[model samples]
Target: MNIALSNTSDKPIYQQLFERISAQILKGELENGYCLPPIRQAAQELSISVITVKKAWEELERCGLIHTITGKGCFVAELSSDRKLQIRDEMISKQMLLDTSYYKSFGLTLDDVIAMLKKVY
Candidate 1:
């Protein structure tokens, strides 16, 4: 697994870990049945707390992006292409809801947001 952690970001370390790994798994960059490193190893490599990596792994399992086997570590879940798209859309939609709320609070319209996104994206 590849990860880059930002201590300065507003998001917690565990959340960043979860989002990046999940995106990788959904994008097929991390193939189905790929075994993730154990939590302690991941934490040590990432220079973060073991508890944080464990939390992120748990969230991945909770979202059905990965599954754990006793003594075997966690592996990426096997998912159909359609299911991957579905999960990706669901995750994006949830983030969009939060982003839209933030934009609205700033009095930005959909067009304004789209325009800004176009420039950044």
Candidate 2:
């Protein structure tokens, strides 16, 4: 597994770790049963505090993307294709709502948002 952490990021180190790792897992870059590095190891590798790694790992577990085994380490959870799609959609939809709300707050109309999205796509 690989990750890049930005020191000047607005997001916390743990959240940045969590989002990137989770996105990688969802993209099948991290296979089922693949064990993530230990908290201390990951922290050392990333040059961040171990507590940050621990917090991110706990969040991945909370999202059901991984599971921790006693005396071992966390492994990516096996998910069915349908389940993967469901989880992916749920995650994407949540982000979309947040993004849309931001646009709405800026007084952007549906047509305005669609046009902007079209330009990007």
Tens-digit per-residue lDDT, 12-111, candidate 1: 9999999999999999999999999999999888999999999999999999999999999999999999999999999999999998999999999899
Structure candidate 2, residue pairs in collision: none
Superposed by TM-score, candidate 1 places the C-alpha of residue 89 at a distance from the truth, in angstroms, of 1.0
TM-scores of the candidates in the order shown: 0.93, 0.91
After aligning candidate 2 to the native by TM-score, how far in Å is the CA of 52 from where it should be?
Answer: 0.8
Worst 10 residues of 1 by lDDT: 1-10
RMSD of each: 1.2, 1.3
Q: After superposition, how far is residue 107 of candidate 1 from its true place, in Å?
A: 1.3
- Tens-place lDDT per residue, model 2, 1-121, is 8898898998899999998998899999999999999999999989999999999999999889999998999999998868778878988898899999999999999999999999999
In the predicted model 1, the residue pairs found to clash are: none
Q: Would you give me the overall lDDT of model 1?
A: 0.95
What is candidate 1's CA lDDT for residue 77?
A: 96
TM-score of 1: 0.93
Compare the candidates by TM-score and give the number of the best one.
1
Clashes of 1: 0
